[model samples]
Target: MRSKPLLRVRKTGALMVAAVIAFVCAVPLAGAMWQLTPVLLIPVVVFVWAWRAGTDVYADELRVRALVGSTRVPWQRVSELAPDAGGQISALLDNGNVIRLTGVTSDNLPRVLAAGGQQIGHSDQPPS
Candidate 1:
């Protein structure tokens, strides 16, 4: 039997907060310093990144999203998964690249693993 689809990772909350902070700082400055309106690009870029960037874990692969597109890494390419110092989950790929999962944390690592088809064997489930 197939399991339900993996839920999307949670990064939108941070995006909303970042958008608000960016506008608050950029608008007044842009109004007062018309010539420096270009400076607002910095915050605008950050807001766009926050809105566009995210990671999605699937049964067979991991998807990393960006403003314009996304990249998919199959489970076979995943060599390691662990929590980093800042609490984000990081993956070491067989290609020797380490990618930080945008919305995943240590606390949610087990869930992500299960969604990726790792046998988590939770005690709460009855043994087959």
Candidate 2:
């Protein structure tokens, strides 16, 4: 059990802001046009995806949460964290499968590593 709340790593905060803007814009259109009410679904989905997608670092394990589901990997199971071609960070698991950390990127990898209780070296990036 962790004494502190889980540490989180997320994509740009811009996503959530966009979701809010979309919802605000849709509200008036939906109320006036009536037919635009169904359009509200778009912002709702965006809000869920933007707000829910991220990785949460717990004491014993790390959870990669997505819009629809989540996957938890124990610290011992992670062999390394590397970036994909798209520059998104991924975890190379001991079992040989790679788990793409949704909100993790090279720039934020160090923070994520620290939150996971992994020590960072002098290098700008984690070990390849």
Show the colliding residue pairs in model 2.
none
| Residue lDDT tens for model 2, 12-101 | 778888988999998998999888799999988888898889988876788999989999899889988889888898899998999999
Error of 2 at 80 (Å): 1.6
On lDDT, the leading prediction is 2
Per-residue lDDT value at 119 in model 1: 63
State the weakest 10-residue window (summed lDDT) of model 1.
1-10
Model 1, span 48-100: residue lDDT tens: 77776777778888887776787788888888887878899888899899988
- Indicate the TM-score of model 2: 0.79
Error of 2 at 96 (Å): 1.8
